[model samples]
Target: MECPYWLTSSQVGVYGRAAPEDFTADYEHWKRVVAQSYLNGIGISWSSVRNVMDMRAVYGGFAAALRDLNVWVMNVVSIDSPDTLPIIYERGLFGIYHNWCESFNTYPRSYDLLHADHIFSKTKKKCNLVAVIAEADRILRPEGKLIVRDDVETLGQVENMLRSMHWEIRMTYSKEKEGLLCAQKTMWRPKEMEIIKSAIA
Candidate 1:
């Protein structure tokens, strides 16, 4: 079923921020832009993907964007961001409040896909990014995909970290310092080994 382009937002004309219409248009544009990555670059197989998590969900737009797909999204709003969770609930969507610097409450391998929009740059000043990525690894299923959008420098840093983690870099593109990266988690782990020393005469 298709979701209506407009949603009921109590923050409208009251939050005194941007216009509600502007937010609607913005997220709609974001939805279209994200769809392109799926169509051409990352090539995510939605058939097997059932669980999705929007790590820095703003007004639950990413979840709205994928409404047609047979998947449910856990829209996670940052504690530092504005209070938009109420608006998300008003729109018939559910989500949780979280601080990415800390851990998200869930089991290991809980999600099939995790998407973050500029979250790394935002969190780097506040906490350790390695912890955030490690938490992501703990929750994402094996071979699950992760998509991130950030500045080019942050993208490069995260790409290198992911490579070290043995995650395959699926796609990366940077446009004027704005970048996007997609990677798939692997099952590789460090193996224990023993070495024997030989004495030479």
Candidate 2:
């Protein structure tokens, strides 16, 4: 079956002062973009819309802004534990989450079509993206598409990597979405112990 494009959000860390203006503008814009994307039959699905909704509900006014959208946006929270999966599945959704709190050697499996938002710009945090993309592909259903909105700037490398993994690059939008970079997750494989060890050695 063809994999669907899924939305993935990143974990919010204690970065610089919060930018409410940017956040609000982006949230409304994204709501429209997402709504339009889904309405156009682009195979788009939200990963953890609940989280975004909760965070932006009061501050970003998402409920009203996205009320007219027809996409199946589910209630979601950060997936810091495996237990979060059943909750999402109960909602009739196959969502994606990231686990970057580990070493490169301990990279986790990609949840097919994992949805992620706001990746780190620094190198240390940037390394986590591989795991994010890898896991998304790993757990994704056949021909699944992974969707992400991150702050990283290496689009070429990211696109190449996805293609190498057999994912078809459907479409990509730059910081136009308020520093929210979006990409599709296609065919991908979770790196095996043999492959990792071989590369390490």
What TM-score goes with each of the models? 0.84, 0.46
| Candidate lDDT values, in order | 0.78, 0.41
Tens-place lDDT digits, model 2, residues 1-201: 111123122322122223333334545665785566633545545442222212111122233345454433322233343233333443344343433433222133322333444432322253454554453444455554545554446454566667777777777766543333234544345475424332223
**Residues 14-72, candidate 1, lDDT per residue (tens digit)?**
23544476456656765897687664568788898999999988777788778778888
The 10 consecutive residues of candidate 2 with the worst lDDT sum are 51-60
Off by over 4 Å in 2: 1-27, 41-98, 101-113, 120-128, 175-194, 197-201
Q: Candidate 1 overall Cα lDDT vs. reference?
A: 0.78
> Residue 120 deviation, candidate 1, in Å?
0.6
Deviation of model 1 at 101, angstroms: 1.4
Q: Kindly give the number of clashing pairs for every candidate.
A: 0, 18
Q: Each model's RMSD to truth, in Å?
A: 8.0, 10.5
